[model samples]
Target: MRHLLLSTAALLAAALPVLAQEAATALPETIVTATRVPTALERVPASITIITRQQIEERGHATLAEALSAVPGLRLAPSGGPGQQASVFLRGNSSRSVLVLLDGVPLNDPSEANGAFNFGNDLLFDVERIEVLRGPASSLYGSAAVGGVVNLVTRRAASRPFAPYGELAGGTQGTVRGGLGATGTIGAFDYLASANGLRTDGFNATARRFRNTLNERDGLQAGALALRLGWTPMEGTRVEGTLRYRQNRFDLDSVPRDDPNSTGDDRRLMGQLRAETRLLDGLWTTGFRVAFTQDRRAYVNLPDARSTASTRDHYRGERLGFDWGNTLRLPGLGFATDGALNFGVTHAREEVFSLAGNTPFQTRVNAAQDSTAGHIALQYRLWNRMDVTAGLRHDAVGSFTGATTWRAGVVYHVPELGARLRASGGSGFNAPSLFQRFGTIGTAFRGNPNLRPERSLGYELGGELDLPLFGRPDFATLGATWFQSRVRDLIIFQGTSVANVDRANLQGVELTLAVRPAPWLSAELGWTITDATDARTRRPLPRRPEHVISATARLTPLPGLVIAPQLQFTGRSPEGPFASYRDDGTSFTTERRNKTGTLFNITASYVVREGITAFVEGRNLGNSRWEPVNGFQTPGRSLLVGTRFGF
Candidate 1:
């Protein structure tokens, strides 16, 4: 795997000059996640990836996992099938260390194992774009950002009076999906509304390579609705609000047991209201936002098909958050003219409730916590060539000690060489989840209230170069980065209770290249090498692959036809004989290693008319039987066909 990645990097470097065209155009992509403000991508001083709506449509990506798999310095592990449990690891950090946001609202579930966001059932029907930041961002976002952040931006209203769109798709395994949406602007108000649904008969989630279960086929049924409204009351004043809801139900299989009468259901609701105004004749701007979210889950276990449920469990989680901020533009100081000051205050409250019945140990648990935070940031440009940014934040939790975080970054540009040098360093922390602090299920597992928050310090240095081909507007870009992080006070489980007992260190290098050789063709390649280990035991982290590579190419064969091929490679990595307890009450651990694996996918789309389009996709083309989990089976080959209409 190492040789393959190194060879691919060399090939991309050697082919850059030969593929250059005569275009010298600059790519001006605006991103807001890097610094909590809209900033040009080239000057952000951080590693970020933007997946646009056009790319999503062309690639036929239906879910967030599929769209994010092509990014560097990231890895995903799925239990099995669609709508199944999945975990994302960024830069070798724990799955719970990454923060997920929907239009600036946090989406983590307080009742989950570690308050992580499940991407399994998150569809992309009304999404406009996705931004992924690849490093710590605790200075801007409060907690759960020790690794990175993923922000999903929903589609906005169009300029026209009204526009409507719809799609229908079907595939193998009894799969069917559909969606409808409308967006438009009327007078001083703009609105967008959308709904989507999916149903599929999936394979058994616990099927293993050497053993097959007798359980019936697990299936999934899901639906979602989203609405957004905005009003422009005056020249510099605006009010906006959003509402989103989703529900999913799926069959389940008990680990190490063939249980066919088990099932689960999940539902989520989120809403936000925001207002913005400019003051002092456009010299200052201020904004305020409030958001609320709720998550509910239910599980049932039946001993027989004709018998009543043997056991049932219910869980609910809720969060309320408020934020207010202002930014002021300052006059030139010394050699810097583009100067600004930013400050913000935030407050959040979280609660979790759990109930169980028809079991040996029926129990109920309820917990809540609140936090308040304040932050300040500064930005300046020197000689119109160097950009600098710095920020500091302090948080006060209901019971824990106060925590503080800080970050600083710089970006320098060289016009003659068409290159930029950037570097950033920051501190991050993750507050303990409700489940870890107070949860208890029967007498099997217990939570400790004395657990401390996990903390980390990380830094990165990188550079980017843009090269024009044939003096035309076509160009190619190459970027490379080196990053390292050290974490302390890690939390883990001991016996039946959770505790802080581990520490870790992770370091990695990432290389990426994007080329548009001609108007009809474009390609991208990325490679990442990571070294993650336990700080105390000096052992490799479980499931942290040493090398990863991804590549994609899009071609326009005809006037309205597009074809794209994508490839992803995961290198051999270590797995665990995760700790487990037998029915007889004996505890033990297991160990193993996972083999290297690769996947290839292809998609094609054609515009049939002015407002109609058709598409087809093939996934897992090679029929690879690799397992992302230690004892689970991954899907083989599958195909889907779809059509879309716009008016």
Candidate 2:
């Protein structure tokens, strides 16, 4: 695998120009997450993936897990179903180290043990696009960005007349899904509104290998609504407000056993307001943004065969944040000119109230934290062939010591060869969760008041090339990157307490290819090879898959029709908490690594009318019922049919 990655990298360096135009008229792809501003794809110095609405609809991606599962350097572990708790691991870092943003609003739950974002419950019907920027980005985004950042940009109000859309689908296991929305502009005011829901009577979530007797269906019901209003009084001057609400309930399955009565509910409300304008004839721009979010969680578990205990839990968490940003631009002013300089300051307050006992008045695990940070960055292009970027940031969280981070990147273009060479290095940090810093349990377990934030240093070297294959100019594209990172001050549980204990070292390589051998045939391939280990013990990190591969092919045999087939392969991983059972089949241990697996999926769509389309989706077509985490069962084969209307 290592040799293959190197060979692929070599091949990529000899391919076509990354910015070569298909016909000299195609516009370059622009992105915002990489540099906190709109920048051309070839001009950014980061490993980033942009999934547009067109791509999402073409592939029929419905959930965050399905959309991200194919990313080269990303891994998603869904506990059981679409609504179960799903953790994201980017480039071998912990899920807590990855920051998630919904339309510029932070979505990490402050009450979660690791302050991580739940990837399972989100419905993407209102999303316009998703931007995934890989590698350390604390220099720009602060905490929870030690691994990477994901920004889900919501759909915007169209500048044209009002346009309405709807979708409805039904499938196996008594599942149903639907969405409705409209976007348009009237005079100076523009508006967007959308509502979506999904429900499924899921399959039994007990691994057959674990001897499943209780085959109760684990299911989920989820719904969300999104609305936005904007006033574009003039060019370069705009004000906007957005509101979103999501609610979900999902059944849970016990590990190493089946629990028929365990279930959970989660709800979130989020709001944001922002205004921006250009000054000095577009040479300077300024913006202010503010957001508030609330998350509520409740769970109940009756006595199961695994334990003779019944429990009830609930948590409430809130976050409020404000930001002011400015950008100055000067083209051809100096050797390192033609780009913009950006500076920003942000402040956020997070509060959490959690009770895990049988009653609402149970013992408390409540706390709050505040973080204020400022950052400045410079991005320039030297003669339109070299792209350079640098940034520095400092964050002060509550009473803890300060954290400072910095990042630098450079991309050198070889336009004649259609190739670009890129390199970037950065430092990042993840602040301790509120529960880690202030929560306590009746004298037996005390929170670590002195716990420090986890810190990491990472770097990546990469290149991209245009594929001039088969006498076709820019017929395809290939890219490769080698990355490494070191994370220190990992938090670990010591039976009764938690402490910042070890360090981790991770290294990986990613190779990607996008090819269009024919007008009607297109495909993409991604492969990753990773090595993650404990800095001190040199043992493989838990749950880090060593090899992952994803492939997708799109076939369009006729106009207004598309058929796509996708596959994902995950390698064996090292898992923990080894358990042994006696001959009586009573009280077996739990938490172990799952076997490697490959899953199959396909989607077919056809336009029935000018503004209406019908589609069918097939997931887990092979019935691979594989597990990403031991004791957590994945769904089997299922089929769904739906229609989309737009007029």
Candidate 3:
């Protein structure tokens, strides 16, 4: 691994000079979080990757998971089928360690049965771009951001008069898909809307061992409708509302014999509304947003249990918030003050019921969380052509006990030294999930209500340098960053022993590089390696892999044509077949198994006419057989051909 690091560094050094001699577009120019004030990507202190709209269209990436997989250090844990359920991992951390946001709105739900949003069900038809920040973000984001953050920014009404577009795609395994989108301005209002549907005969979660391996192979069907309406009545005051609905149904076949014939059907519907006033007076911006979401899932198990053979789970939540922020430029002390003061109240409710014939063990739970947070950031330009930024934030989590969280950080730039330095330390926490509190059957095992909220205190030290002296042709932005974070009290499942089982600690690193030699070609590579062990026993984390690497390249050889090829490699990771088991009555441990796999995906597209295009994509071009989850195998070599037309 050390050698690979050195080799990559050497490669970058060798490629930079060659790229400098060629004509290349500057790195992407817009970002919202690095400065809390939209700034160019080149100025951000952390390692960030942006998947542009062009990449989305040219690569034939139809879903969020597929789009994210080509990125290094990021891995997708797919489940069931299209729009079913999938988890994203960053730098070796699980989905529980990553934070997901849609235009700054957190999608995770402690009220849900699984404790996290089912991302597989999220359709990407409306997404404009995706930004992935690789490393500790607790200083900026808060809890569950221990690994990183994936921010999905949706599209807005274009300035164009009026436009409507749609597509139809069909493929193997009974797969069929279609979508419709429209954007325009009418009078004083601007609006955008899109609806997409996908259906497929998903592969079996487990292979031949089970009786219904094919039975385990189920069907997947889901649809989503999202609309955004904005009214800019005046320059200073504007209002916008967004409504989205996602419906999904797929069979779940990973149930133990103690409870067989188990399957799940799930549905989610969500909406948000916001109003902002710039005040145009100095640098004051005030905004208010009200959001709501509801989720329902039903599961059916063995009819021979007792008498009742089915279970039902219903979960729902809503959030209300108001915020006021100000930016004050003070040249007097070389200080610029920008801060946001936010107040929000949220309500959550959940209920799970199990029935067998005449017997039923039903449970219902509810909770409310009110929070207030404030943060101030300062930027100073020193005499040595150096720029430094310092920031601090304080958050109060609840009204009952008032749990508080805080974060602080600073970034310094030293151009003469050819180095950019940044360091941040922060504390974040996540409340216990509803399923963790009230015993339930979402997992083959039972939940423990005694579970406690997870918390952590961690810090990171990182630096980046540009190697323009190296001689590679397509070396656009050649820089690398490394970061490490320590997390304590990580949430985990426990079936026995003290506190009836709970949480642990986690640690990890990430590396990325971008090379764009000429205007006609480009390539990006990334790698992430992690080590998460039981702080006490030093044993490996259950399913987290140790290594993940990816490479992507694109070529536009013709005026209206684009072709891309990608390679994804995941290093052997250790996992136990069962969470726990006893052998020969000795209770000895079962040796962990390590798996290593690779996959290739390709796409080709051409514009046959203005606003009209045809494309074809092949996934797992290598026809590689890989396992995303234990015993559950993924698809092998699949093809999708489609076309799009617009006015």
Backbone collisions counted per model: 14, 3, 15
Q: Per-residue lDDT of 376-439 in model 2, one digit per residue for the tens? A: 9999899768999999999999987689999999999876666778999999999999888777
Task: Output the TM-score of candidate 3.
Answer: 0.84
TM-score of each predicted structure versus truth: 0.93, 0.95, 0.84
Better of 1 and 3 by lDDT: 1
lDDT of 1: 0.84
Model 2 RMSD vs true structure: 2.8
Q: How well is each residue in 9-101 modelled by candidate 1, as lDDT tens digits?
A: 456445544444332436779988888767888878789999998899889888888898888999887767677777888998999999999
Better of 1 and 2 by lDDT: 2
Candidate 1 local Cα displacement, residue 304, angstroms: 4.1
Best by lDDT: 2
Candidate 1: regions farther than 4 A off: 1-25, 256-258, 304-309, 356-364, 443-445, 469-473, 579-588
TM-score ranking, best first? 2, 1, 3
Model 2 regions more than 4 Å off: 1-27, 304-308, 358-363, 579-593
Q: Which digits, one per residue and each the tens of the lDDT, describe model 3 over residues 254-368?
A: 5221223555666666677888777546355666666656555655554544336555545554445444445544433444322333223332232333222222345444555
Give the whole-model CA lDDT for all candidates, comma-separated: 0.84, 0.86, 0.62
